[model samples]
Target: MAIAKLDVVALDCPEPRKLADFYAALLGGALVDDEAENGWVVLSTPGGRLAFQESPGYRPPVWPSTEHGQQLHLDLTVEDLDRAEKEVLALGATALDTEDRSRSWRVYADPVGHPFCLCAG
Candidate 1:
């Protein structure tokens, strides 16, 4: 049997609602559901569903620090790194680190502190 394509991408956060809102705006998605009783929130985007689950004891990743494990990251491809960086920063992403701006990729952290990268396409 062949496996079907992936349907959803889930993330753990201290506040699922807040994170859901951020992603909803970023992905141009709608808040399809928020099951507080189940500690989950889902955003429906054209590309796919992004789900956030509430974890009261959730500790965010301390990237560049081996003590904390990286939970997850999203790699986005853009036409122009500079323009994409500016847009994402306006959306509340923070600059984490970069090796070469002249190169094709840049790493950044979301508002809630998840690391992601933008690469040239």
Candidate 2:
């Protein structure tokens, strides 16, 4: 039996609302900002919920390296990798490992520098 259910995956960012907006746009969710809760932001999506917390001196993790660590990354599945890659890039995602187009997955960094992958399943 499960002891507890997962509520939401939270990420610490310099600006909570902005990060929440990015995910909401990408994942098709409603953005909820709770100013009373000290600038906490949440995105409610069909798959699950994601919360963003404010961290004044937040320094984004370094990709492809364990020095600063990746912290966490989201794997978003897509039907057409090419199409999705283009859209994400336009939305402020920077390609980290996209030289090999034949690969099943490509790594990218978000506007705030967190690494994520667009995977073809």
Candidate 3:
């Protein structure tokens, strides 16, 4: 008797199309651009569906600080940490925490400042 099932994980951003493209490139998915349908974009991947909603006044959160905490973040697993890091950085992701290279995970911010992690699989 489950009351609900997880459908999609949506993120709010100033530009839905751009955000969707970024995720699509990172995760290997098919993007559905439907800005006319209420400023929403969907990315369909084997893992799941990721959506982006347009928020005109969206403000990115500051991580590790309660003043403006991270609203939420995605944890993406990769086969090779170094390779993934290089790819993501070239795709406009900012390194948030990469000082400790021995760790199993590293943090990075998407182009517009949404923090996400690249974890070793």
lDDT of every model, 2 decimals: 0.81, 0.87, 0.90
Per-residue lDDT of 45-105 in model 3, one digit per residue for the tens?
Answer: 7789999998888999898678989989999999999999999999989999999998999
Model 1 off-target regions past 4 Å?
3-5, 36-38
Which sequence of candidate numbers ranks them by lDDT, best first? Answer: 3, 2, 1
> Can you tell me which runs of candidate 2 are displaced by over 4 Å?
none
**How many Å off is the CA of 20 in candidate 1?**
1.5
**lDDT of model 1 at residue 3?**
79
On TM-score, the stronger of 1 and 2 is: 2
The candidate 1 region of ten consecutive residues with least summed lDDT is 20-29
Q: Give the candidate order by descending TM-score.
A: 3, 2, 1
Best candidate (score: lDDT): 3
Determine the backbone clash count of candidate 1.
0
Error of 1 at 75 (Å): 0.6
Give lDDT tens digits, candidate 2, residues 57-104.
889999889898999999999899999999999888899999999899
Task: Please give each candidate's TM-score.
Answer: 0.84, 0.93, 0.94
Candidate 1: pairs in clash: none
